[model samples]
Target: MTEHLDPDAMLVAYDAQLRAHVPPVLPAGVTAEHDGPLLRMVGFDHGGFVVPYRDLSGLDSAELDALIARQRDFFAARGERFEWKLYGHDLPADLPDRLIAAGFEPEELETVVIGPAAPLARPPVLPEGVTLREVSSRADLDRIAAMEEAVWGEDRQWLAEGLEKEIAADPDSVTVVVAEADGTVVSAGWVRYVPGTEFAGLWGGSTLAQWRGRGIYKALVAYRAIRAVERGYTYLQVDASPDSRPILNRLGLASITTTTPYVWSPAE
Candidate 1:
């Protein structure tokens, strides 16, 4: 049954429909620019994100070297921590190696899971004393960020800041949902609806170790899926980490491809 959903085709659709079609609707102060073939979103000061697309099959080693240099120089000049997103199926199979040679550090490789949101929208039965809530107030947002920090073992101030701006700009486009148990946020996640596209993004799903098997994560997915459907999005896409991949697979999302973010930070 799943074979009918061609992973290659889905990947093609992702690059074309999502990456090429709908650019990110960034926060108020950010600026998105088209520098020839690259789609660059800047203004985060600390860094930015870049999307590069092309058929590398025709380029020689020299040309490939030059292209990589150009990308490096472009971001380096800005003194930012830029991430160039690359997919598993992208051409010139050695592209990963080239990125490493250009001072770009590869982050974790994530499986790109995507599927219709309907199957995931059914609310799961939560454990007793657990409740789900769509975060609205600053207090709720802080709670969610705190939960994420505990889960990831890092200061997640960026998560809180980004969510605050997103909510302030367009609350409907960003849904940050959390599962509260006994007045404490146990698990949290968010969904981003990109207007002008059929896809929504699922991000920041993290659960405390004690709440692992209870179904809080699934509830978070369900709530976000419901919100995505309400916003007229057909598909939900997530860059699934090893821990969440199996769970999301059970929810019917296909792991169509792998993606790795090669990050470049300007020299000090």
Candidate 2:
């Protein structure tokens, strides 16, 4: 982390590590299966997830088209929604178009940013009257869902369900924290110390509208970074939204790729 980092080289390592299935096992309620080069996780509370390993270069046009359709049917049979995690650098260049043609809808684009965790583990910097606390109770989890709902104007009941299952399976691998002021949760986030990898994935940082630009989000990042560092992780990673991408970049995480989700919902 001290010497100048070669972003390209580090990114290559990150891709390789991910392709190897760094976690190696899904949570208890979920399962993984392979469709040729693509690995899919099924039974998440939200639905299935396609791992974005970026290994589609070898498939021909027809073969790729069939692969996309197959995933759609696979999920439809179970009446579940699914997502194909597509990155800007994923090969076949037309993969995004192919997904769209298969009835998949593209969602928000995010940057895949990563950085050395050591430097980011400084004491959290929160605004006056704000305090961050690590959370575990069901009440705390419900509060996080409420915070997310207020930020995005939708029911986020799925967050509590998924986080509960994950925490029950391995308390050591995940950490959830919330920023509180005036006895209410204002911002929340979590970090997963993915097993068998050098990286810890950071999720959330959903702050209430009234709390924007107050450094609570950044403090959440720093707090998660500290947990990652203490847990022996070398790098911190996030699929950064536009609002957070600039802040993370300034904090030293390199934006190596752009990830956009292409989703398919089962017909009612």
Candidate with best lDDT? 2
Residue ranges of candidate 1 with Cα displaced over 4 Å: 1-4, 21-25
lDDT of 2: 0.88
TM of each candidate vs. truth: 0.91, 0.96
Query: What is the C-alpha lDDT profile of model 1 across 123-150, one tens digit per residue?
Result: 6678999998787788888888788888
Tens-digit lDDT track for model 2 on 1-268?
Answer: 4245677876797788765373544567798888887888898898888875586879899999988889999999999999999988889898998999999999999999889998989999889999999988888999999999999999998898888888887788799999999999999999998777888999998999999999998899999999999989998889999999999988889888899999999877
Looking at model 1, the pairs that clash are: none
Q: What is the C-alpha RMSD of each candidate to the true structure, in Å?
A: 2.1, 1.6
Clash pairs, model 2 backbone: none
| Consecutive 10-residue window with the lowest summed lDDT within model 1 | 20-29
